[model samples]
Target chain A: MSYNKRNDGRAFDELRPMDAKVGIIKNALGSAMFRIGKTVALAAVYGPSELFPKFLQKKEEGLLRCTYNMMAFSGSGTRVKPGPSRRSREIELVTRNALESVLDLSECPRAVINVNIELIQTDAGTRCAGICAASMALADAGFKMKDLVAAVSAGLVGDKIVLDLDYSEESFEEGAVDIPMAFMPRTGKIALLQLDGEITKEQLREAIKLAKKGCKQICEVQRQALKEKYKTEE
Target chain B: MGILIEDKQIVVPGEEVAEGMDFLPAPGTFRDGDKIVACQLGLVNISGRLIKVIPLEGAYMPKRGDVVIGKINDLTYSNWFVDIGYAYEAALSMKEATTEFIERGAELTDYYTYDDVIVAKITNVTKSKSIDLSMIGPGLRKLQGGRLLEISAQKVPRVVGKQGSMISMIKEITNCQIIVGQNGRVWISGTEIWQERLASEAVLLIARKAHTHGLTDRVKAFLESGSKK
Candidate 1:
């Protein structure tokens, strides 16, 4: 398939328009709706509540449960899987850890936090995007978080390492190995890291830096959405 | 109060971004090397550089002291498990659900059944996430013969505003009794159907455009224009 030109015709580093809403779900402890260009995600945060299995219950902190799903019609091509898959499981773990890094779990011992990420639309970098959306949703739910978690994906296409990978670039780019990473941009700390394909050590370092930059930008959007959601409070 | 940036909203502690710097995107030291930059502020830690913003700590957290609006998802054994939009279902026992002592053999459907909207309180949240709800509170009960609209839960506070300012504004204009469920379900009723409809529309508008600037004027204008003819 032939590739279509981007709207701005800018080089690969630029990002598309983003729309984010915090606490979109009425019932969840926290929830958020995030849209980046054609890709969209709805994330809900529930927890600091009782744990189910007696053994699974922790005495030190709350347990984090994350479920990531892409609706059947959320993507193009053959469509996404209906139930949870290995890919979904991986995404869930990554998201859970990313969120765990920022949350103060000690406040809710023996409790659990359930984060559900629904991909309403799939463009690219869904895993990283999902983590970012889920963290914002968690914050919106008013959970005690030490910091806001942010994430972005970068890939090596040809000789260039692009930030915020889109679907077309992820599939069509030659020798592309996508790296979806989650980080707390404020602390310059890594929460979750997964790299596919291969790159030189220098390229990997560059990729991490670029990914951090992208995550920082995404964090700004999350912040903006929260402000909009809560501005009326006195 | 926080700063509003280029119509996009942002919140920072008094020490983070100065008053003027927050109004413009990328107006402060965050600019790229020699590149004019614009970005909204997200978080602000004690050290001060822009960070991800966390919500202000509040008292309510699906607790026993608050009021909520919820929908009934299922009914069983003279009890109704209502979906209050919380993580767990709120079990409204037959006794707490209504004044009468509902027996085990009673027809649950005759009382609050599936898909019914109710206003209730969290009587207890078990260590295992099981929530016990009560409908016997002052304003708690089954919402009979009315429609419930769901909005984003985070926007509930904005719609209600500080000290019920926003809600009072809508009530004064539409002349309707609007019961706001902390969980984001709004129950609006009025003698005139059109008035109730108008108020619902107005509340939804506020929910959508709450992030925009000058919301007070915009909402007042919307209510005024809507009430005319």
Candidate 2:
């Protein structure tokens, strides 16, 4: 496969620019916005309040629900409908799963924590960016989590493995597979793993290793955001 | 396992605390295989044979045997539903609430009216997340005629200090009758409203700056300055 490097001029294993800011929404108990390349996602956390519809309550642990959405103007042209699509629904479930793996949910029993993520801009890795923002928002809400978790997308472009693909790299060429991985840095556990295209065993193994390393770096950016938000005068 | 971070070190979420069976994970920490991981942003306090993470941002979570201040939110047939400031409403059974047994059909409000804050002890926290509260123990009763103040539950330990020294100092200096609930509620009653407010401010200072050392001296000085002004 002949390549003139990535469109963003990043190496096969290089991630896009990342930035995060916590407590962006004052009313939200916890809130954060994460930007990865051109993808921007805003996440907010509410409750740890009450669990409604009483019958569904978990006796031993708090219930966690996540809502993943895409803004109408988030994508290029032809405004997308601002409602839950099958795509958003699946993303929401996985986002919740990724965050719940790290949150200490049992600490606040009989309650519910609502995590909302809105993709205000899109590139290629919106789901991973959504997971990144929501996890930090939970931590900002003062919930003691097992550890901060993050996600990054790596893909097999032709025979090359690229980290944090942009929209062009994601859909360009045939046989390119998207592998998004969400992980907990503390325990080094993979919370959410999704393969959007087909790939061989050898490629999958290498992609996992590369994606995890990228996630750790993203987790550091998340950690910095948290530390700044919760900084107290010593 | 050997501890990865030193004692009193600030650890963020997902940071490894210890790696090996040589260390035990305490509260605010969880164990993964042989590794002890910190799941909160807080100071690491390694006690004997145990590694504890003291979370800086403490949202109150009631535990068994905690002395808490709860308000009567509702009254059930045999229980009084108490709001302890969290989502879960604790149940104060009539039997456990009072040793006295009255005949059936007695008014519940006659004993403790709605919104009446009471000092009680958490007797049992069941698996279903139901909390059982008892007021039969010593110094536990319906609190009346006092200004209620709230602080973070995590700061309660620092406010109480070693052997009740911190609280006693506040009471002695402010000349107020103070009762602190483990849920981070304080009932301060003084002869004058200003003294009560003054005492509350002193406690607030402790709550805000609890992480600083020599807090007792600082609090005393603060109270002294307030009293002079």
Q: TM-score (0 to 1) for chain A, all models?
A: 0.92, 0.94
Instruction: Give candidate 2's TM-score.
Output: 0.85
Q: Which pairs, if any, clash in model 2?
A: A146-B39, A147-B13, A147-B14, A148-B13, B1-B20, B1-B21, B1-B22, B1-B23
Instruction: Return the number of clashes found in candidate 2.
Output: 8
**Docking quality class, candidate 2:** acceptable
User: Candidate 1, DockQ to 2 decimals?
Assistant: 0.10
- lDDT for model 2 comes to 0.85
Worst 10 residues of 1 chain A by lDDT: A1-10
lDDT of 2 by residue, A1-234 (tens): 545578778888888999999879976767899999889999998876778799877877889999988898899743357888888889888988888787778777778888989989998798999999998888777687877879999888776888888888877776678999998875779999999888889989999999999998999999888776545545
Interface RMSD of 1: 8.3
Model 1 over residues B1-229: C-alpha lDDT tens digits?
Answer: 2332322235421113324332222321232232212222223321233423322422134656557888899887767888776545678877788887776576778878777777898888665446788988688877776557877655677789889999999999889888888767799988788888889998888876755557778888988998896
lDDT per residue for candidate 1 within A7-122, as digits (tens), equals 24645676667888876787776788888767898998776555788799886666889999999889986548788888788778778878877666654556678889999899
lDDT of each: 0.71, 0.85
Using TM-score as the measure, the top candidate is 2
> What TM-score does each of the candidates earn?
0.60, 0.85
